[model samples]
Target: MRRPAFHTRLRAHASACGGSSLIEVMLAVALVAVSALGLIAAQVWTAREARAMSLRESATWIADSIAEATRTPSVGNAALNQWSAWASVLLPHGDASVGESGAVAAARVTWASVRDRPTAGDGIGPSAEPCGGVDAPAGSSCVALAFAQ
Candidate 1:
């Protein structure tokens, strides 16, 4: 049985490169799992920020709509109520308020969400809003307009 010189070299190389140990494989898997978990966390944060931005955009739209309607004689508390109802339906614990004094008007919308995955609404969550509810942090969006005298 005469094996080729190359066969002997191959056997020596295989012995030298005995693949990964159990600990090495475990460590590699742990690192991969950690990286995946970090990626997932970042995705979750992005989703939350996206949702908050959407709510802010919607609030701006609602404020603009209310301001436009404010010109009509029939627009007042009823319009605010309708918009409040609409906002409530659109966002969790959503509320809308409109205030007018003389020639100035202000519209604000507030909502709640667990943007930072806080165990509780500790008043220190990321971008905490003054209008949030009990279980989540609050966020507010507002706009003000003045009519010509």
Candidate 2:
């Protein structure tokens, strides 16, 4: 019997392999989609962290300002209130307070932070006071500075 021509054999092989290319393409597309989703999640997390950091930096600056004002005898409660007002304007539900414990004075800045989600068993929530024992609201973050009297 005469053997089939090369073109015929190639055609037979191509027909046999028909659906495999489609499957491979589908798998590749799925992989790319999953990777893209992961990248997008990372970007979102990064943006949230950047915003949280910016808020923390602002809190720190406010705390430092409080400390400076405390050191200066001329600076009064009005100045401190102004700083608190500034914090409120700059951060979400922000507040600042100055407290004295014995010889050490503390400046506490508190704000509601998007990143302050309550984790499991951490016991951190609205009532949890993390900033030098100051009463921070729910889902809030704080920055505290202690300076000598």
Q: Return the top candidate by lDDT.
A: 2
For each candidate, the alpha-carbon lDDT, in order, equals 0.66, 0.85
Model 1, total clashes: 2
- Scored by TM-score, the top model is 2
| Per-residue lDDT of candidate 2, residues 1-149 (tens digit) | 77669978899999999799999999999999999999999999999899989999999999999998888767758779899999999988999999889989899999876654665357653456566766665567899999986
Q: Estimate each model's TM-score.
A: 0.68, 0.86
Question: What's the distance in Å from true for residue 105, model 2?
Answer: 0.7
For model 1, name the residue pairs that clash: 129-138, 132-138
lDDT, model 1, position 65 = 69
Clashes of each: 2, 1
Off by over 4 Å in 2: 1-6, 119-127
Local accuracy of candidate 1 as per-residue lDDT tens digits, 1-149: 89999999989987887775666999999999999999999998888789878877887777676667666767766787788898888876777766656666566666665444543356554554332222223333433333421
Which segments of model 1 are wrong by more than 4 Å? 18-31, 117-149
Q: What lDDT does model 2 reach?
A: 0.85
